[model samples]
Target chain A: MSTTTRMTGRRIVAIAAVALFILHQDFWFWESTALVFGFLPIGLAYHALYSILAAGLWAAAVKFAWPDHIERFAEAGEPEGGESSGGSVRS
Target chain B: MTPMVIVLCYLALLLGLGIASNRFFRGTSRDFFVASQSIGSFMLLMAVFGTTMTAFALVGSTGKAYVRGIGVYGLMASASGLIHAAVFFLIGIRLWSFGKRYGYVSQIQFFRDRFGSSRFGYFLFPILVGLVIPYLLIGVLGAGKVISPISEGRVPPWLAGLVVCAVVLVYIFAGGSRGATWANTFQTLVFMVMGVVAFSLIASKLGGLQAATQQTDPAYLSRAVQNVEIQTREGTLIREVGVPPLMFLTYFFVPLSVGMFPHLFQHWLTAKSARSFKLMVIAHPICIMIVWVPCVLIGVWATGVKEIPPLAEAEAGKVLAMMVNLLVHDEFVTGLLTAGILAAIMSSLDSQFLCLGTIFTNDIVLHVAGRERFSDRQIVWIARGFIIAIVAVTYVISLVAPKNIFDLAVWCFSGFASLFPLVFAALYWKRATVWGAYASVASAMLVWFYFFHLSEYGHEYALWGGVMPVTFCFLAGAGAMVLVSLLTRPPSPAAIEKFFPQQLEIDQ
Candidate 1:
């Protein structure tokens, strides 16, 4: 396979790993913790999670969403007739 | 003079600047809305710093650390800053690059242009502006409340909020980003001085950090995994703490969506250079440290106080207010500090209000009205009017919302989180289509609101704590976006060529 396909495969695998981690947390951290340790530590852990996640989510949004806008936004600099409004249009 | 007088003098200074900056405003819509794209690194730093660190940092976060002990010092105060620094590294540089390339004015403009779909603009702008306005209003209401009591009821809360709103609107309207930058520079100095005075005095009184820690329990200083779960208001449950490895992964992936927020992107679009952005990335970590550490310490310090301020039990945000009131006995310092806090509040409020105004006027209004090339005079008034209206609405929402500051803050940014997937794809994935963006945002919001907000209020699940709502939203939304975009045909090469010429060039 080409280098492009290799990178895509790597990204997909990385995404899968993340998906597994989050799913595991939902089970182990949220469910298993309460069963073993009393609720206080679990509550504290959840509160920490809430705060971190809020900020984390926003940062994630930025990383994922910004490049597309940058590329799309770059269209305005293009010479006319190459593209409509100097943006990508699928034929 | 008393702190109150110092405060009044500060307010007078800000008002004078507002009036004075108008001459330099150039009366153009773009200038009024975005400071004519001439915002430098210093101005941008002040604007971002002054706005992001607000009454929340001053009172709320510290108060939390005080009550919760030192756990907050480690997690909320320190970690948040560290994470924000990380965010700047991952996303800030890219955002600045786009902002320069597009001459983009608002977050919505970036979104609309990126998706190459005007429809996405219509969907995204309202939700973003809506979320931001209430958050801004809440800041105003809280500041007003803090100021009124600090003045010994000499100033009314509603009046204070109104006065703040009016002053902010005038300056923001008059000079736009320039006004925000100049005002923020003045404001940041005031806040830092007040912070130093207040923290120093409190530390001395409490026999310094070691004694204060002992008094408040040394456990606060320990970064152990103990007591992570506790009984909340609703019932016994696990407390959400720790940067779970899962969340750390999300952090790596999630900043991928930074392009989605209109206000955040405005910062991007207004950068002087990619180098300036890079500098901001390097410097911002230290800046976050300077700002958050003292505030958290103050909070932890407040916990040791024998006599607490009233109403702190009901709300955490008011803890800082009570701390300020409890600690400061002298009138002069109080007035100066009050002015500083006002500066902090206005710093955030003015920037947010301007952001909201630009989003509405530029993206929502102009797009819907189907107009182009509006007169400079018309644009300025419209932008100002939108700001005033948004502030008013937010003020009312803050009064009536009945949510805790922490809860509200997290919720306000929920859309950004939920929409992260769609945004990431648009940026990095060449095949990401417009429908994918819309679908991802919708799916994430639906799941988030259902599980986190509505489910809790509706009392749907007391025992079912196995699933993390955020994780669920991330997977569901992100999965949907990729799948949907893949299923759909890609955009025309011609359209892609016009809009994404750089990507094409880079590819070449």
Candidate 2:
């Protein structure tokens, strides 16, 4: 893969690992089968992964719901120096 | 010197540092406010963490844990910390990347740039400033209340608070974020050390971590799996507060959205690079866990130890002070720990003061005055003046405000929640019309005022179990964004390309 893609991939992995560490308890879950199924519905899984997944779903919903609008907004040209094109231009 | 003397001396040293840091101020308005965008990731990271762990966490969280049990400790302290980390991951990195690339300077700028709405900036500005004033006042009053008893009432709580605010304003006004960044690092380190020492002392007194934790009531430890009934003072069963574990998965998004808070956005904006931003985000969950769990556990332990008075009888923000007094009778250590708590309070208050002042100067004042560029010297002075003014206003409010910290905090969040959805839509949805944004903010605030704030109707949304109003506010904003944008002529292609270049491929 290209350098930019590789960087992006690394970022995703790093983010995922950090998310897991934050939400999930390695010590709590590694030994306890009861925890895995018990917390799944509440998405607690007592793990950071649950928290990360919830957030990811919310963000994805937002992105998917407004793909067209997002594209249009992105296509909006850059504001000229000292001029705001999005609204009334200030002198 | 005695503990009080030590604390006073620490306060003086902080003031001196604030004054010293002022030398770095480059006489620019932006420099005085945001340090002219010179802050790097480390400073930004420290500032983010330091500014967020407010008086509430220091005192109220402990008090809550003391009263409610370990479940309160986990929910208020650990959950908040973990959720905060979640926010950083989902939104913080993107906000930082966008702000740096777009030259976004203020929360208003972000809302405006993302939504292309001058009106949205104008609308949200007042609401932000309004919410921020009470929020800052809580910090001041909270610190003051804690310090007063510690000083044997020698330094009145209000005066102690005023002094802390004055010292913060001095450094913040002079050095801007530059001063806040370095000062916050020291402040955070002090808090971390004091926290660990205090936690260890408390844990040991309770017969070590495992023993103490095991002693906690089963219900307190079971919030993850159990649903408990909440009761009113009259013994009436209030509606259940906790959703099922499955429902909590969805409800978890509420606090996590705090990453979208304006102050958090500013931290993201100041990071040196996207990598630095990511590192900070990744590190946050660990940092939060280390600090929060011990405090919550301490709170849970306090509940079993003795009979603390009910909430009304006790000073609202003195729970930590009581715990410290009970645990550590050593005068010097007490003073140092008191100073550490003060550091946490001041660090949070200072960053907020800077943020509020900057928003007023950059978003409201500049917009209202219809002038953007002035000499850097004038801007710096004006910005400082705004800081002083904001502090004074908040002081008066805190002095006279009738409600307790929790009530006030909820109110503050209500104000921001009204506006948060609009900004969220603007970023993610291209069709988010300015009119829709305005309507959502206006209607939500209006509903909040009438139902939650104003005339006491028996049927209030916040008090009652109606999720509909909040859900409606969120949906109304999103709906307005879609319906209005679709109905109106699409933004000019040049404007679209300028405002949102990533969307250019849609032309095909």
Candidate 3:
């Protein structure tokens, strides 16, 4: 992917992940009486699914939103004086 | 073996571990405070995970789930899983880079440098310490609550609190952050394994998952409370068992506290490289699930267990231990499970204690009194002195000012969460000014104090009836940052260039 396209894709993913987090806080499952497999409450089960989805979203974030400067810094290895190169892009 | 003996043996093992780590200590202030920035990814993951999962996750959550029902999981656990990892990815990585660049060992140092105001540490140092003391109390109180019941009156609660405080102090004092990290990694494994074991055993003993759910009130299964009559000492009392929706929604802000914790800042600095944070970010939510789901399930099960009596608010913290004793006939299993609970509690206490000491030694003593005067050995000793003093103060407070572990933790996290806007803005917003940072701190503290005072009268009290105090404090802090910075001049271009170079380049 082109640099700009990848950056835009990351921005879109970041916004979507944040929106998903906000929507997760709403009380949609609060009144649901359904139970998952007849044991877990619908609310409890909803959060369990949410936790899985969150894990996936965070993995995506690591792949995309991760700052390229950090990747370059890691590749360059620790600087001689232990100072981070100030010229790198900000995260 | 007796539970007290088991606990004593565990403490002995911890002391041995602390003493052993001392041999590996490099005898430098850097090694003591930031572990020489030598920690690998796996150890970093364990240290971060262990520190975050405190007594609040195990004992308090179980007790809370018993009273509030399954909604307890949603209140903090599920949201925390995602929010903590997100914070780690966004805030932690950036801070690690800065700390690596600037050699910052504490949050105070970071703020002082970022805002170009040494005196800013004066305002921040007190608020961070004041907030951490209550957080320290949560661990001490939780240790007492777990040990007191399992020991069945043989060990006094004060003695339990003292033992935990002393054990944690020895390791942290002897070996510093390296010792704390080693201990936390070990304890993390112990508690995670035993948490699942205890959960599985209790569920099966109660006659399987389906049978357990059949016994619970249907209303308790959902977010809405089931009004149930409990047999108290005087008479039957009606109690609400479940969580309120709005209060639950607002708890989303509480987990954001991880972003602003000074101890976590110190931990982030200890990372060998930025990549070390990847293991922490990816596995943090999974680790939260591993530890929390069992505790929440056990807590919800406690509500329906016919053998266990309905618990009053004060006694509810003991629900985890009560379930262990009531269901498991094996004394050995009970002791091991209790050790697991204590493991979780002590893991956090050691880090908080050490972080506060680091702050005092580096930010206050070295920075204010001048670093040239004190030798590196003297600096380490100064930090050890502060750790001992803080532990003693917290132990005494735990005995006198007893509160529920979960409630105290929430209030503590709210204080940190309220300050999140300051850190977030300082890192991300190039226009954030020193005055704005001050306003954010002042506004957050003022709003937090008002709600904290109100909570003392009524535990259920919320700002404007529904919103949690954290929501208001976070907004007020963030709003003050934007408004004050816009009204005032932006930070100096040089300062912005130093921190946000890429943004400055774009602006030009």
Question: Which structure among the candidates has the greatest TM-score?
Answer: 3
Per-residue CA lDDT of candidate 1, range B1-508, in tens?
3656776777889988877877787766656655666677776766666766767667666655654544444344434444454455455555555555545566666667777787787787667876676568667776777678766788887777777888887777767777877787778777867777777776676676556545643333333333434344565644333233333333332332333555666665556554444444434444555555666666655544676632233455665555656665667766766776787788878778878888777776666653344555776677788887887787776667654444455445544666777656765677878888887878887876776665453221212332335566778788889888889888668646543455533222
List the DockQ of the predictions in order: 0.08, 0.11, 0.31
**Candidate 2 residues B231-343, lDDT tens each?**
33445432222222332232333353364466666656556554454445545555555555566656655544553333321342455566667766677878887887888
RMSD of 1: 7.6
Model 3 chain A: weakest 10-residue lDDT segment is A82-91
Local lDDT at A38 for model 1 = 22
Worst 10 residues of 1 chain B by lDDT: B458-467
Rank order (by DockQ, best first): 3, 2, 1
Better of 1 and 3 by TM-score: 3
Is 1 or 2 the stronger prediction by lDDT? 1
The lDDT values for all models are: 0.59, 0.58, 0.82
Tens digits of lDDT, candidate 1, A34-91: 2113212342344344444434443443333223434344333532221011122111
Off by over 4 Å in 2: A1-88, B73-83, B86-90, B224-253, B256-260, B307-317, B370-373, B454-473, B503-508
How does model 1 score by TM-score? 0.77
Clash totals, every prediction? 84, 27, 0
The best-first sequence of candidates by lDDT reads 3, 1, 2
